[model samples]
Target: MEFVAKEKGFIAHFSYGDLHVSGDDEHGFRPFQLLVSSIAVCSGGVLRKILEKMRMPCSDMKVTAEVERNEEKANRVEKIHLHFVITGEQLDPEKVKKAVELARKNCPMAQSVEGSIVLTESFELVS
Candidate 1:
């Protein structure tokens, strides 16, 4: 597997194992970070959409990922913990939980990574 990224303007070419990334800024982490970001973003997006559709009116949503690395395998993230903090007004807890469950079911990224990766979810509601 190979990935290639050509410079559009500011960043240089980047190649990785089936994933490519480039940054205009110097502080970019790596391609693995991009994968984590993608998962987090996808989960958040699905949850937000589901909540909104349920009339929950999500005022704020945050997904924080804590990745556990393999000690003997050169620091590769083997498992991930996804902590979600959802803020809204007049929200039903049961509906919120259902939305999260639906989001996990419908999230493409989560489905793609489910077999090979361990993903844990915890939620908090802000009144």
Candidate 2:
């Protein structure tokens, strides 16, 4: 990925599109937002695949993330809590929980931040 410096921040150009990154949200996506998003989205993607493989595919899944930051430590990210709401028919709660566990274990983004950022995942099934 290549990033071009702008007056306020940087814009990363990729095959998908351009991503604006900055310290301030007004300029673009904050660095912490991107980092947390990467972890949540990556985990969700892996979970989707795991569900399909387990024959428990969901019609929809939404991941909500809550981040904890330490103000004294340069506002560093301390923990991220991801709650997943899964909508599907005849879904097994136990299986979905297992899939979540597997996703957290396998997601590259989460693994990359392992031992540095604390991650927690929880899921609820809706028919």
Candidate 3:
């Protein structure tokens, strides 16, 4: 991964593609947004795999993240809340909860920021 400084911000070139990041929302994704997205997507992937291994058919899944930032000091992220909406047939709530727990424990991104930031997860199973 490499970043080239632009007039407004920077363009990060990765194996996948280029990402334009800036403090301005109109320009591109903010750095903090990227961090939140990484955590959410990482956990979502793990959760999906866990459900699949358990033979739970997930027709659709969406992971959304809400971040709380500290008002004082540097305004860093204080907490992240992940909400998952999973749609399927005959989805057991208990099993889905277990999968979410396992995902939180196993997600590398979540683990990385565990001590510094508070991470919370909740899920809804839709039939």
Q: In terms of lDDT, which candidate is strongest?
A: 2
Q: Give candidate 2's whole-model lDDT.
A: 0.94
Model 2, 21-111: lDDT tens digits are 9998999999999999999999999999999999988899999999999999999999999999999888998888888999999999999
Ranking by lDDT: 2, 3, 1
Error of 3 at 4 (Å): 1.2
Off by over 4 Å in 1: 1-27
Clashing pairs for model 1 are none
lDDT of candidate 1 at residue 11, scale 0 to 100: 30
lDDT string, candidate 3, 1-127, tens digits = 7788998889988888889999998888999999999999999999999999989969999999999998796889999999999999888999999999999999999999989999999999888
Question: What lDDT would each prediction earn against the true structure?
Answer: 0.78, 0.94, 0.93
TM-score-better candidate, 1 vs 3: 3
Q: How are the candidates ranked when ordered by TM-score, highest leading? A: 2, 3, 1
TM-score quality measure for candidate 1: 0.76
Clashes of 2: 0
**Residue-level error in angstroms, candidate 1, position 54:** 1.1
